[model samples]
Target: MHHWKPPPPLSLSLRSCRFVLSFTPAPAMSASSSSEVAPTGPADAIYRDRILSSKLYFDVPPSKVPVIYSSSYDIAFFGIEKLHPFDSSKWGRICQFLIKEGFLDKKQTVEPLEASNDDLLVVHSESYLSSLKSSLNVAIIIEVPPVSLLPNCLVQNKVLYPFRKQVGGSILAAKLAKERGWAINIGGGFHHCSAEKGGGFCAYADISLCIQFAFVLLNISRVMIIDLDAHQGNGHEIDFSNDRRVYILDMYNAGIYPFDFEAKRYIDQKVELASGTKTKEYLDKLDEALEVARNNFNPELVVYNAGTDILDGDPLGRLKISPDGVTTRDEKVFRFARERNIPLLMLTSGGYMKSSARVIADSIINLSKKNLIALDSPLGRK
Candidate 1:
């Protein structure tokens, strides 16, 4: 396994917390299990049964496009969401912009169901799920102080409910991509949360859950995660650390949040960027990284964590990439997958600025213009 050497220490900021992570290999699956055996492990059986019984994977009619979103995906709790830097309503705005611009028809967009307790259990442990019932734990995970004071029931209904809806979107996106070649979840990419832990404003392991569901339902074995979010995607990295079926290509500002040196060891291909890196250098590195990733792994599916946080002027990302750079980046990734005929699913991961919605909508428009993704087909036209 490839290991990343930690960079020299730098001046610390409020958002940048440095931590050394110890690498521990997860326990291996038993050798007694073979293709001939019915795969009888209790843990494996529970996970498989949960996935097979999930309502998140319901069939969408031919009239609807593969773009997944729901009005319930937006979180607003007595205006307390304003306390956090994240734009809680960004998901809704992205879809609104696309509809107003004629790039998409509102009637054709698919609305996803909220992920239930059983669905979450496929990736999250029972204890971890129980921990979320504490309003204090949830507030800490989401980084909103006011949320801790609210009753656990209210918090669950208002805040975590929206996130669970987004999780459903992410999981469903994989299935849609398999059937349609490409799909996008307007929200999701909680890359900071894992099966047993939640941090960095991420409460659930959506990426990990999505891939797990894909492995079971889509009949896909090899998967690649192309996480271009500004922050390191430690959540999925940690979850898939011992699992060889997933290949991770993570490129992010190394100086940013969740500076997990341990999780860095899990990345199949790690591309670290410095603070305030400009657009030209960012795009150049991505081009090369994609080339190397192509040469290295042949995957049945590609999960692209397209975070707009890398946009210029974003306070959180600390990178200086421009709006057009974001568009070009998405285009390049789409082209890469399209050319290879590989199924791809994109998640709008993290971007705190309000303008993130516009940039994302524009990028989707650009993709449509380039014929990289079809927003509407004659058969699906409304």
Candidate 2:
């Protein structure tokens, strides 16, 4: 195996950078124009009111770019994270690479607020939120056995707190995307956890919460979830199963974890890849799938769960897609949304390997090179 190291920080020159101003406004829909009725029941009323009153969707100035992250998003608890297969610090590492490469300005990157309990209740059940109070439940959900032995207070501070912060980032990203045409939340896409349950290292249903907020606050009637993670995004699948307003296109390894047969039924477009699937086959399927999805549903917004677990050496994903393939995959997805003039919010979901952070950082740089995403800062150039 090749040893991985953080790339040396690049000294950049502003003259070498390219700038093109392009903005696509979201499709207009009045806030009061929903075909759905207002909430009648107590539970629905509370949820609706919480969403309406939440400050998570605060305005982001145009001067700042639409990449959302926070230092709190990285989880570390005295080496307990090392017990799991996942690289818990990958979120911070991704940002570090981008900053070191001069692709991003640390000050310009938007830091999101932590999702309060009321904000989380927008999608998660009260019982589900309460269950997280126990370290054992959180441990089981995150697949970290030693976490169970840790005190609940430590777990809450070290683990779930970071997740809540990321959840806030995911929720805010939709609002940013609608305004900016595209946004990326560096630390979200917890797609294995639904409103009622958490599993597969995903403790919160950020995708569901994001879409829900978009539907209500952004005046977005239709949304598409393009989950290209190596594992099935059963959490969001189950959340939006009966909702016609949401269309799901999930391309994942069929033989992998969370092989949820039930969630399979909810995918509008399911591209299941076998173990050892190559880059060509994967990209080919994604191309065809995107075409089909475009013909099937015209969405106002697109939620892309851009997971890097499909990287060749990722043990969990079991796919042979190269680093270049990952970049190409993201580019295609961005192009698809750009062509449609639809706003897109991308979340960095799964991929536990140490190299995952570099791969993701490289992919974002590739997107910038292709002009699919614009890093507006002058610091990152050449």
- Pick by TM-score: which candidate is best? 1
What are the models' TM-scores? 0.91, 0.89
Candidate 2: Cα lDDT at 296? 88
Local error of candidate 1 at 334, Å? 0.5
The digit string of per-residue lDDT tens for model 2 on 1-382 reads: 1001212322222211313211111222332344443565776677778888998999887668999999999889999888787888999999999999999988899999999999888877779899999999998888778899999999999999999999999999999888888899998999988888788889988999998888778866788899999988978877776666778898988776775655666777888888899999999999999999989888889999999999998978889999999999999999999998899999999896899999999999999988888886422221
Q: State the local distance difference test value for candidate 1.
A: 0.85
Q: What is the lDDT of residue 117 in candidate 1?
A: 98
Q: Report, for every candidate in turn, its global Cα lDDT versus the true structure.
A: 0.85, 0.83
- Residue 243 lDDT in candidate 2: 67
Query: In terms of lDDT, which candidate is strongest?
Result: 1
- Candidate 2 stretches with Cα past 4 Å from truth are 1-37, 377-382
- Show pairs that collide, candidate 2: none
TM-score of model 1 (CA atoms): 0.91
Candidate 1: C-alpha RMSD to true structure equals 5.5
* Residue lDDT tens for model 1, 1-382: 0012234544423212324332212222322221111235777777788888999998888888889999999999999999888899999999999999998998888899899999998888889999999999998888888899999999999999999999999999999998888999999999988888898778999999998888778867678999999988989988877766778999998876777666777788888899899999999999999999999888889999999999889888889999999999999999899889998999999997899999999999999888888897623211
